[model samples]
Target: MSQLIAPHGGHLVDLLVPEAERDALKHEAAGLPGWDLSPRQLCDLELLMTGAFSPLQGFLGRADYESVCRDLRLADGQLWPMPITLDVSSEFADKVAGAPRIALRDPEGVTLAVLEIADRWQPDREAEAQAVFGTTDRLHAGVSWLLDKAGPVYLGGRIRGLTLPPHYDFRHLRLTPREVRAQFDKRGWRRVVAFQTRNPMHRAHLELTFRAAQIAEANLLIHPSVGMTKPGDIDHYTRVRCYEKLIAHYPEQTSMLSLLHLAMRMGGPREALWHAIIRKNHGCSHFIVGRDHAGPGNGADGQPFYGPYEAQELVALHQQELGIQMVPFQEMLYVQERAQYAPADEIRPGETVLNISGTELRRRLHEGLDIPEWFTYPEVVSELRRTHPARHKQGFTVFFTGLSGAGKSTLANALMVRLLELGTRPVTLLDGDVVRKHLSSELGFSREHRNLNVQRIGFVASEITKNGGIAICAPIAPYAEARRQVREMIAQYGLFVETHIATPLEVCEERDRKGLYALARAGKLKEFTGISDPYETPESPELRIDTSEMNPDEAVQRIVLKLESLGLIRPRD
Candidate 1:
């Protein structure tokens, strides 16, 4: 008697082996070639096994991969908007070549599944990126990961799950597709409308979702992605706590909260269609499709990649085939006169509307400014504040990059002493020579080695910033691209201040305290920066100091002023 939509491809495709067969599968997998799945791959496999990614029994083989990329459909004409492929290094591909099966394990060495190999091939990644994401530009996060981080080869086959990946936290709230459908059945909820979100909900979200469900005459499913989202998104732990608090405000028996482990691609319009199919698999009769659903904010050009209404339009185009009704997200605003949320289009002509954008909300949290009760719940704000303290109270990094002997070390040492004098936080100095002596004793001046050294420094600084400490790093990070990589790595947790010690190269050579520039000029040093090798200057740094014209104290004072202006540190009394 339920009117819920059927799973994609007509059945819930659960590949998890029955209890009777798991023991044998595990035993057989021990002898097969093994691959430790990455975090994103593990999330994909979990959904495939649990029927959350229904119709995808395994990673796509060559034929299916090509088909999905060229068009958002399987070879058999089933609509699937995304391609799920398991990529591996060339060494693994050669080892698994012509093998009947391979074992997949987690980082802890626990065998989770076995893949019955069907096909192995190297994909034209550029083509895939263009067709699937509409661009091959590295500025897009997904495209960047695809080009730089992913492996060279892909393996595709059917998967036999021996055990589901273990999640110790929020175990009760993590429901499989079957379990959620069963819950709906138990509640006699024949009509269920699912709302997908990756961010914390405010009053506007509650109003929009409630109105959506009310219009559809269905129960509400508050499903949130707990896996990897945008790089700087709120951590799942904090977002989940916020969800737990917000759900209390909903009417009992009308709404349910469930967590999903989905590594989102931020694919914009295509992602909207994929999400609709997923909700259909979860036994929902309706799904909410909003403006900019699943969109990665902007491209490198600082323009929106997809039109604001594109996602809604794309879902509407395919909802009939997808079998899930689309409930468009209503733009709700708090009417000041009535003090209640009303659809933007339906408000009276003279009525005032109040809204809080995500940027404003973050600004309020960062500056420790008051967030109005009309915008967000007090409990939710408290949970956010616990994770994101005020900007001045939070930890940050000060990175100094310039040519060798450009007074970077002196300025960094002076700044470290000044921070230590404040006696507010732990301060650590990572000078180039000191770090080379300790951390990079084995690394040489090759481009690859230099990149590795900078990455190691970025990782250490990120940890320090994450734990509420100050890290002052001074290095001749010559390549602009490498410096950008470090900036991206550290920006996820805290502010990354790139201070360019813009002393002229001639002045740096004239100082030559270590006499390295002399050796380079005499052709004694190979691949020496600014001599034999190229040094790409930063296009725009947070602070640029001309150490040739100013002493170390003045340079440090300039940096301190920059940090204070950005609210990273308090002004000295």
Candidate 2:
């Protein structure tokens, strides 16, 4: 083993306040303004304090931020690829604008660090998005978060860490950058190759990583991010369990597993570079850069934001400066006849090949289809099945939205009764009027208030689905955007069936079960849908029923049939 790779900026920077001085720092922070750090910010602080992001002493100042956004370099010309700034709301910015120092606290109000406020400003976030991410479309997850979730102003300064955020689970598996470097040194692993992944490793991943390590003649570091990832990805706990199962296949002492607390930006090429820098800080001499590494998938136009090989090319361009070798991930296919994985290009002519895509894997899991052992370890498949049961066994939501007299509640009641008779799963009915009386008693009829009410219903439905129960919600959720938001929220846990009761306004007014239509017409109900407020028709709905054409029973039967076809339910014998 030779000398270990140096930190990104020529020296490791540890910002954790020494144990002897932590008490004093706490005393000093007591009088300062405090910010309860978000989960993403907590990840950033941990990396900074542990020297994982060594070149970064703290959050980016205005100068460094502007430089990084304009050019993928720090103000001092170091090859730093991403901007790391503390974002705060306008109100919070005002509160801490002139403060000399501010405390960074966890959600439980424990101080984690103290920031010496050096610069604060409102950035041109649109420009920053374009320069860094190549697009400002909301379809891109990172850009959507930047524009919607991030605060209005940026705060930057150096930080004196008081403590690392507490992690109750995976305590033994969590290793700080310094701890990993120490372990590598003790094991005489100077040449280490690190693999960064957010998904569960199938045989494809295992073969790719093994080949990269062999090529580099380096020890393997299975560093997977435990922080936020793509919204629909499998949870970290299940992923970690899968990793643990696959680790037995590797030669002992030649490979190790550690969790990385990184809230990925999904910045594609730039993210790949950032990963390399961080891996180098963790004493890795080689980092694997795969096709579309860290990419957030296609945008609204159905095209990828970057070329497939773009990440590999960018990492190769800066490999010399980065001091980390770039390991290009080759396309590997499972050879059916050979019963092994081989590089796609190197396969002999006419050899049968089988490939499993992420989408197909999810479909197989949902439909209780076979996931061949050649694709992944049987133990890993079993763990995944424990968490992700077949759709017929999982909970789901049936959201019915329509005009006031559109028979949504009537059809919902019928559906609820039918589902209960099946006795297959627990069923909860959340009628719009009933929920308004209990859950949203004091809410008004403003757009914001209506959205909030729908969000509340979505939250409850998501919880029910997560616990393997059916949540049937019938609400006059007039806005399509609000419905889309709820769908996204519930999709994280289980299936969301959006049923549109597209009864015509004339027919609904004629039925007038609630007489709310008369009040809306008389101006008594100001913001009523189909009168004063508009109902944005759903462009796509799982099932659309018109009460005029069919009775509530018939509509319920149609919905049940759709669910059966989707593998969400089994037809009664």
What local distance difference test score does each model get?
0.88, 0.90
The sequence of per-residue lDDT tens digits that candidate 1 reaches over residues 303-354 is 8777887989988888778888999875789999999998877899899999
The digit string of per-residue lDDT tens for model 2 on 1-573 reads 012244322456888877889899999999889999998899999998888887888999999999999889999999898999899889999987689899999999999999998999999888889989999998788898888778989999898998999998788889987788878878888789999999999888899989999999989999999988888999999999999999999988889999999999999999999999999888889999987899898999999988988999999899889978899976789998888998877789899989998999999999999999899999999999999999899999999999988999888888888988999999999999899999999999999999999999999999999899999999999998899889988998998999999999999999886798899999998998999999999999998888899877788889999999988899861
Clashing residue pairs in candidate 1 are none
TM-score of each: 0.94, 0.94
Displacement of the residue 241 alpha carbon in candidate 2, Å = 0.5
Stretches of candidate 2 off by over 4 Å are 1-10
Candidate 2 similarity to native, TM-score? 0.94
Candidate with top lDDT is 2
User: For every model in order, what is the number of clashing pairs?
Assistant: 0, 0
